[model samples]
Every structure is written in C-alpha cells, then in structure tokens.
Target chain A: MSSILKITDLHIAVDGKPILKGVNLEVKQGEIHALMGPNGSGKSTLAYALAGHPKYEITGGDIEIDGASLNELDANERARLGMFLAFQYPVTIPGVRVADFLRHAVTNRRDPDRKEGENLMPMREFRQELRGRMNELGMDPEFARRYLNDGFSGGEKKRMEILQMAMLKPKFAILDETDSGLDSDAVKVVSEGLSSLAGPETGVLIITHHERLLEFNRPQFTHVMLAGRIVETGDASLAHELHANGYTTVRERHPAEAAEEQAEREETLATV
Target chain B: MSTVTVNSAPSLPSGFTSDDFEVFLQSRVEPVWVTQRRRVAFELFQAKSAEELDPEEWKRIPARAFRPEKFSLTGKAAIGFDTAQLPLMQNRAEFEGAVVHVDGSATESRLTEQLAAKGVIFGDLATVLCQQADLLEPHFATKAVLPDTDRFAAWHGAFWTGGTVLFVPKGVQVDAPLYSLVALAQDGVADFSHTLVILEDGAEATLLEETASGSPDIAGLHVGAVELLVGKEARLRYVQLQNWNQKSWHFAHQCGRVEGNGSLQWTVGGLGSKLAHIHQDVHLDGRGAEAQVNGVTFAKDRQCLSYYTQQTHNAPDTRSDLLYKDVLTDESRVIWRGMIKVEPEAQKTDGYQRNDSLLLSPTSRCDAIPGLEIEADDVRCTHGATAGRVDVDQIFYAMCRGLTEHEAMHIIVQGFLQTVTDRIPVELVRETLDKAVEVKLGIGE
Candidate 1:
C-alpha cells in the first residue's frame, strides 16, 4: 500500500537557523505515526512544515500527498485538501463563540450542493449538531457557547482542539504534543478521541514526548527525530528505547552519523 | 422664460435667526415653563462658539474640513416611512417593547393612539408641549446635557424644529422599541432636532435614534441633541445608529442621567458621514446608578474624525464604563479622546474607559487620548488604548486554514469589531452592521 504522505529531503529553517535540515518520512493511511524527540529536535517544526506553516521556509523539500506536490499550496488550501493541525497550544480567541467558529469551518468544508441555498447552518440545527459532537467527546454543552478557548483550562483547550479535528474530519491530522500539560485522565480521553478518528483514509501524525501516550494509542510507525533530521525509524517499540536510553546515548552511539547524512543529502539535492 | 439651473441654492426661510425660536416658543398653548427654558437655552446657545480648530486635539476630525453652509435639506418625502409607528422590520419584534419613528422636521409619527392607552406617549415635542406640556417641561434638556457647550448645541437648542418626547409612566414596561430618525435632505440645508426620553420609576424601555440623509452625495448638516432621564429603579437602553451620507456633516450631543438604582445603556454605531462629532456624556447622579457606553466607527479614504466622551461618576457607589473602537483605512484618520471623572464626594466609584483602533493600511492614522480624573480617594478608575494592525500570527493561522490573506484579515477585523455588533438589540441591524463592516473592509461582493 502506498503512503498517504511522502516527504523526501525536506529541509526547513526559520530565521536562517537550521530546524529541519534534511528529513525523510512516510505516513500511510489509517496509521498513527509517532515522531518523538527531545526539545529542539524539530518534532513540532516537522509537523508545522508538513502543514505548510509560512515560517517553515521549505529550503529543499519534495512533500507529496499521494504523488501530488504540496509545497506550493497555502495553509488553507492544504486544509481544503484534507490537512488539519491542532496547535501545541491552541490560541485563545475572545468574543468569538466556539459554535460560530465551528459552523464557519464546517460550512467551508461542506460540498457545494450541501451548502446550496443554505450556507449558514441554522442556529437550531447547528446547536443540536454541536451538542451531539460535544457529547461524543465527553464535553460540556456550555463549552460551545463560550469564546473559542477563552479562559479554558489547558486540558479543556486540548479537548476542544480534538473536537475541531473530529468536526472537520480532515484526511490528514497533525496533533502537536497534545499530551503536554494534560493530566493522565485527560491524556487518556484525548488518546481515545484520536483512536476513534483513525480510519483507512485518514493518516495522523502525533508529535509527543511521552511513551505512555503511544502505549494508549499504539502507532503503526515510530520515528526518532534529532537535530532537525530523522536519525532512526522503527516500530512502536522505538518510543520505549528512546524513553529508556535517552537521546544522549543515541547521539553518542552515532555522533558523526547525522553530519554524514546531511552532506550526502546536500550532494544529492545539488545534483537534482 | 429663461431656462433655470437645477443647481441653484435651496430656498431658505425669510430670515434665519435666533428670534424665530422665541416667536415659535411664544405660540405654545401651555404654561411658560418650557418656553422660558427654550429662551434661556437659546441665549446660552447664541453665546457659545464653534469648536476651534485645535490641531493638537481635533486636527484629524473630518468635521474640521466640512463647509457648514453647503448642507441642504432632505427633499420632499424621501422615504415614505410612517414616522409614528415602529420602524423595526419583522425580525426585531421579539426583544423590543415599543418603537417610534420621526423625521428631522416634524414628528409625523403619532404612537400615542396605540401606546397612550397603555400610558405611553410617543409624539412630536411640539405636540407634547401643547398636550403633555406639564410632563414634558421637567425634562426638556434638564438632564446631563447642557446647551452652552458648543455651536451645534446652541444651534440645535435655538432653532430646533422637530423632536420626540417619550414619557413612559411609572411601573410600565414597554415591550416594543422607540425609534427617532433625523433625515437630512437637500444640499446646503441644516436640520436641528432633539429627543427627550423620561423613563419613570421602575419603568423599562429601549429608545433607538437613526440619522441618515436622502442621498449619498447631497451635502447636508445635522445638529441634533438627545437627553435621556432614567428615574429611580428604571432601566433604559438607548441606541444611536448614524449613517449620514458622505457629503453630510453631523454634530450631535447625547446625555443620560441615571437616578438612584437606575441603569442606562448607550450604544453608538457611526458608519457614514464626511465629518462627524458626537459628545456623549453620562452622569451617574444617584447612588448605585450605573451607565454603559459603547461606540464603534469605521473611517475609510480621506475621512477625518475625532470622538470625545466623558463618563462621570457624581454620586457615591455610582459606576460608568465607556468603550470606543474604530477601524481606519486608506488616508482616513481617527482620534478617540475619552475621560473618566469621579467627583470628590463620590466614594467607592468605579469607572473604566477603553479606546482601541485597528489600522488597516500604513497611511491610516489613529490617536487615542485616554484620561482619568479622580477626586475621590476610594475610587477605582482605569483607562487603556491600543492601536494596531492585524495580528500577523492570527492572519497566518487563518491563511494556513485555507483562507487567502484578504479573507484571513477580514475575519480578524470582523472579530475585532464583533463587540460592537453583538450589542445591537435588533438582528437586522447587526447583520447590516456586519455587511457595512465587510464593505468597509473592501471584501464584500
């Protein structure tokens, strides 16, 4: 089976700083791919680069989604093509009701025929559907009435992000450290939500530091990112090894490997 | 016969002087109280001066550049809207109590037939003076607004021709809304009007005043005044939605006086007009009285303007809050000068003033002058002003979500101004405001 996402020689940088020097990755449909690394290893950067964040600056990249190059597309265009990013820390927007925002998002994603003559969801129907989705995520009904993420606790914000992901139903989702700052219970709830979203047509890339989260929602593929590039790729057990041995030992074992890999990538790209 | 030019100046009265006001007042059939007050108010009006071009304060206001003599009167029967009944469309009938409509010159509206049975009087001030004169005398500019402040106030007081007088008796809760519209017609004409609202003890009602011109290009002037009186334990919500044509100049003064335990809410949405100035003053005169003022303006192109407001706390434990927001694009400019004043005897007062602006282009300018004067030791007063462009992070977030740069910015700007739109009691008005904002953003189809 072909991969839903293919990133070959993906190099990204911010302000001239090498964030993702040369990274290669593959995400097959229905698979929950875990990219684990220590701080500044470009875990979140890789996710942002894949989602077409403007600041990422794809220096040398050939990111293809089912054999189509996505480097030229803007973020929203990428989203329309079934890509979604749940920020590590969802921004709080005051005065904008969550339900209104969700309605706008849902309307934007609906087929033209579905929106014919009634683009805006009726308030009653919108409320009913929002309540149903909130219930599915084990959220309070009042959560939809308040400002989007305004004054929400950290856990509540993460859950709201997951709720949006569920509502949007994107073909590909990048969950950026959704487990961070969440209690074990919240982590379990969020993991379960992500698990239910997985299907044969949707590929998810979850960036995290905890193996516990991976254990809850076992990923089909796991890769260890270090120094802006993926140094090792394996099964879900790779998370356990990184958790047990630490990144320092992994680096000492292959101190010059990343540098050698970078030179080779530069040579190949220079020729191409 | 010689062919006549259609661009000739509009016909004027035989004489336009303050003496015309005295003669008009003398013909009143009621006692001399209201007439005497109008005479005294006219004297105060004649002695005052037009706002001096204070470059440091009002240089950016569009009013400074308008030629006052160019404004004309609105022509014959501009819109056939019955000035007496509610001007509200069908969608706004749910939350309102009562509604009234009045043109600039005369109160063609006579809501007294429907509402008078329920002890509500909605009609022209002159008719109220002839009929309900005794009741109207006590509130004919007796609240927070004084006529001696500016040239426009004096003009409105001395030559005011048509206005509305709303009297909601004690314990009466009006379920509909009241509307007062000042229609400026004909080029080089001026319309002066006033609206007096007295909410009796424990009474509740919503009063809305709309100002507009017959045509977008017709030069006209409006010097209007509105005074609202909130009796003890009464509640009044006053909304002013002004869409004066771009060629018109609007000078307005509105004041509210809150009695003990009474509350007053004032909202202003200024969208059109080449030069406009509104001085909104709220006085918390009675203990535990509260007042809230929210205003929003959108200035584009070369429109210049300044908005000044004062939130005064005169009685102990009284509270006042004021918020003014503006969006400037092109070479347009805006200045928000606001102050919170707490009297020396007013202890435990709470006052807050906020003025913010969103600059859409590099050339557009905004100035916010937020001030506080605290004479009471136990008062809590705070003022803040912020002027900025759209947040790049927010724009990027929207863009990344598939919206173009323009779409993203439009959403952000709408979000910024939603506070003003959300307060409108009528859904159609809110939607109209949304569409206007979209038009001002240059994103509308």
Candidate 2:
C-alpha cells in the first residue's frame, strides 16, 4: 500500500530551540506506527510540527500527504487535508459546546471528492454516528452538552479527544502524548479506540512513552526520536528492545550508526 | 451591604459642568407634574455640591461629551424596518388595557377613545395630569428614577411633553406589551419621553419600549426615563431597544423598585447612536426579591457607549445579578461600571456582577469597572470585569474551518456577545436583538 504520510529530513524549531532535526519517517495505510523516546526526545515536538502548530517552525523539511506538499497549509488546512491531532492537554473553550464544535469540525473537513451539489450527511445521522463513537470510547452522554473540555477530568478529556479522532476519521492522525497522564485502564481504552478507528484508509502515529500501549495496539513499525532527529527504526520488536535495554545500547554500539539506521528505515519503507 | 461610602473612587471632570445643563433644562418641560418634578429636581441636584462630583462620592460615569441638553431634538420621523413578514406586534392587543401611541415627540389624540371604555387612563403627560389627576398624583415620579438625577433627568422632568402615563389596576395583567415608537423624525429636535409604569401588587405585564431614528444629517437627543414599581409577587419585564441615528446622542435612566418577593428583569440593547449613556438602578426593598439586569452594546465608528448599573440589596436574602458586554469596532469605545451594594443588615444577600468587552479593532477601547460593597459578614458578593481583544487563535481556528478573516471575526464577536443575549427570555425580542447584532456587524443580508 502507498504511504499515507511521508516526511523527509524534517527540521523543526520551537521558541528558538531546534527540536526536530534531520528526521525521516513514513507510515503506510492500515499501519500503526508507535513513536517512542525518553523525555525531551522531541517526540511531542515532532507531532506538533507535523500538525502545523504555530509556535513550531519547520526550517528545512518536506511533509507530504499522499505526495501533496502540506507545508503550504495552515493548521485548519492541514486538518482539512485529512490530518488530526489528539492533544495531550486539550484546551478548554468555555462557551463552545462539544456537539456544536463536532458539527463544525465535520462540516469544515468534508471530503473533497464529494459532488458539488450533493449533501454530505443529515444532522440526525451525523449525531447518531457521533453518539456511537462516544459510546465506544466509554464517554458519558452528558459530555456532549458540556463546554469543550471545560472542567473535564484527565481521563474524560483523553477519551473525548479519542472520540473526536474516531469521528473525524482522518487519513492521518498524530496522537501527541495521549497516554501521558492516563491511568492503566484509560491507556487500554485509548489504544483500543485508535485500533477500532484505524483501517486501510487511515494511518495513525501515536507518540507516547508507555510500551504497554504498544502491547495492546501492536504497532507495525517503531521509531526512536532524540534531540531533534530520528536515531533508530525497526519492526515492533525494536520497541521491546529499547524498552528493556533503553537507548544506551544503540548509543554505545555506534554513535555514528544512528544516521544510517534512520536512512535505511526510510529507504525500506519507500520501496514497499 | 454596609452604608460605608466610597472614599477613593477615581474621578474625571470636564469643563461643561452640570449647572450649564441645568439652566437648559429649566426652559423645556411644560406639563404640571413634569414642572413640579423639575423644580424639586433642581433643589435636590443643586444641593449635590462639588463634593458629590468627586469620584469617591459619586461613582465614575464615562468620560464623554456632556452637552446632552444643548442638542436640539428634532421631532421623530417615521422609521421603516424590513422585518420581512414577521408579525408587527409581538402579542395580541389588550382591548381592556390603557393604550397610548407615541410617534417621536408627538402623541396621537385618539388614544383616549380605546382607553375610555375600560376606565384605563392613557394619555400624554399633560392630558393625564389634567384629566386623571387622582391617578397621576400618587404614581408620577414615585420610583427612585426621580428628577434629581443629573442634568438630563432635570430636563426630562421639567420639559418632557412626549412622556406616557399608564395606570394598570390591581390584579389586571396586560397580555400584550405596551409598545411605542419614539422616532427622531425631524432635524434638530430633542425628543424627551418618560414612561411611568406602576404594576400594583400581584399584577403581571411586559412593557416593550422601542426607540429608533432615521434621518442621517439630523442631530437629535433622546434623554428618556422609565420608573417601574413591581409590587409583591408581581413580575415585570421592560425591554428597551435603542437604534437611534448614528449622529444622535441618547441617554436614559431607569429605576425599578421590587417589593417583597417581586422580580424585575431589565434587558437593554444598544446598537446605534453616536454616544449613549444608560443608568439602571434596582432597589430590592423587601426580602426574597430578585432582579436580573442584562445589557449589550455595539459601538463602531468612534461611537461611545457608557453604562452605569447599580443593584442595591436592602433587605435580607435578596439576590441581584448583572451581566453587560460590549463589542467595539473601529474607533468605538465602551465603559461599563457595575456595582452591587449589600446593606449591613441585609444578611444572606447574594449579589454578583460581571462586565466583559471584546475589542474588534486596534483603535477600539473598552473599560470595565466592577465593584462590591459588602457590610454583612454572612453575604456572598462577587464582581469581576475583563477587557480582551478578539483571540487571534480562535479566529484562525474558525478561518481554517473555511471562514475568511472577516467571517471568522464576525463569528467570534457574535459568540462574545451571545453570552449576554442568551439571558433574554422573550423569543421575538431575542430574534430582534440577533437581527440588530447582524446589522451592526455588517453580517447577513
């Protein structure tokens, strides 16, 4: 299958600090990619830069969605281009209700292939779909009436984000530390929710520290990012290796081998 | 709330003092009741020495042009609205209730025909006092919105000929809103109208006062007053819509006194006029009284809108809440000063006040002054004011959803002001307010 997201030599900075340096990665449709690294390894920064967050500047890199350059798009444009981000700490918008916001997002990110005069979906049908997704994510019915993430518990907020991602069903989704603050039960629920939403038409990249999530979701590929660059890449087993021995073995084995490992991973994925 | 006076309030004084405007008021009012109030207002007003002018003694009014009495109020011309087939009247007409038709500063003569059969006293200030002296004597100037209020009040009390007096008997409820159109129809005529509403104990009614002006080049002044007395268990809603000409100056004072267990809800929508000032005072004299004051102002093109609202909790267990928001664009400016005062013995009082503003343009300004005076230890009183520019991130968020920059701003500003409009109870009035907001924001055809 063709790659859903392709990033080459991605260099990104936030507040004058170079975060993502010389990063290369690709995710094919129907694949789960787990991005794992220690704290301050630029894992979350990469996700934010990929989502076109304003504070993060892409200095020298090329991000393409199905061979179309995404650099020219703003955050919403990126979202319209089938990109969604499940934030670690969701923003609380006081007066905006969850139902209204979901409706707005759906209308905003309509499929481009839709006929000019054809209607997308009726309000009732769209609402039913949203409610089903919410139920699947174990969210309460009253959550739809509340202000967007306003005063929600940590577990509830994470579930809400996953629910949004499931409803949006974007071509590419970047979960930026969605598992950071969640408890063990919440972690299982979120990982399962992502798998249920993932299909041949959608690709997901989960940036998290927990290897437990990888055990549940079963990522096809894994990448290790450190100090603004991807240093290693291998099959899902590499995550367990790094989990057990940490990045010290890779660092000591060949300090100069990190660059070659990342390039090889990109080349292998490109040819597939 | 204790009676402790404000000592360090900031003050802003200008050259055009209240005295100059007082002299202007002496020559305008003609009715007997109006003239009597004018004289009494003069003595009471003059007694307010320069000490009272100090900010600490009298709360800060907005800093704007003070020559309200100088502008000649051209008579109101007819105003035509493209309502697009909506019902002209919100409710069915009350056949047995007093009915008065006001067109600008002029009152229709046959208003008595429909009112005489029901023994309902409805007429202009002069006619009401002459024909129904027994009814007018006890009710006129009975509320706290007395003539002694600054120069505008004095002038309206002394010279207002377009004022309306309606007397609803005990247990008589008017199904339809008492409607009037005070149109600023002509050039250079100040239209000053007063409304005295007395809802006897247990009476229920709604009074809708709609004010608008049409001529572009005409400079008009509308200094109006409304005094309402809501008796025990009585419910009264007064909706005031001010859509005057952009070149006109509008100032109004409304005071509603709520007796034991009575409730009053005041909704004011300020969408037009070059400069406007509104002072609303609610005095809860009896226990268990409740009052809600919600106001919205749209200021654009260097217009200035100032609002001063006060909720006095005089009796124990009384509750009052206020919310005022303004959307400023271009060089428009707004100042909202809201105060919740609880008497010393008014224990268990619940008073809350909030004033927020949204600045749509770089040149626009908004100042919110929220205050509280709590003398009782067992009371809950809170006040907060916030001034914020439209959030760029929020605008961008909407824009990414396919809205242009202007469209995004329109939506954000609408959301900012919708917090205030959501409190209005009447559906027709809410729709009207929404339409007025769209016109102000230059949105929707």
Best by TM-score: 1
TM-score of each: 0.83, 0.80
Give Cα distance to truth, residue B155, candidate 2, Å: 1.9
Residue lDDT tens for model 2, B304-341: 88888899999999999888888898998887878888
Candidate DockQ values, in order, are 0.31, 0.17
How well does chain A score by TM in each candidate?
A: 0.87, 0.87
| lDDT per residue as tens, model 1, B1-445 | 1111121113222223455554656544545775666677766644443234334544445443445444433323445644334222223433223333233556256564556777988777766777877777667866556667655666576666667778899999886667666665555767777888999999998877677666667776677888999999999988877777777677788888898989998888877777777788888998999998888788988776667888888899998888888888898888778988999988999898898899988999988899888899998999999998866677666654545567666667777877766766666566656766776777543
- Residue A46: error of model 1 in Å? 2.8
What's model 1's overall lDDT?
A: 0.74
Q: Which candidate has the top score in DockQ? A: 1
What DockQ would candidate 1 receive versus the native complex? 0.31
lDDT of each: 0.74, 0.71
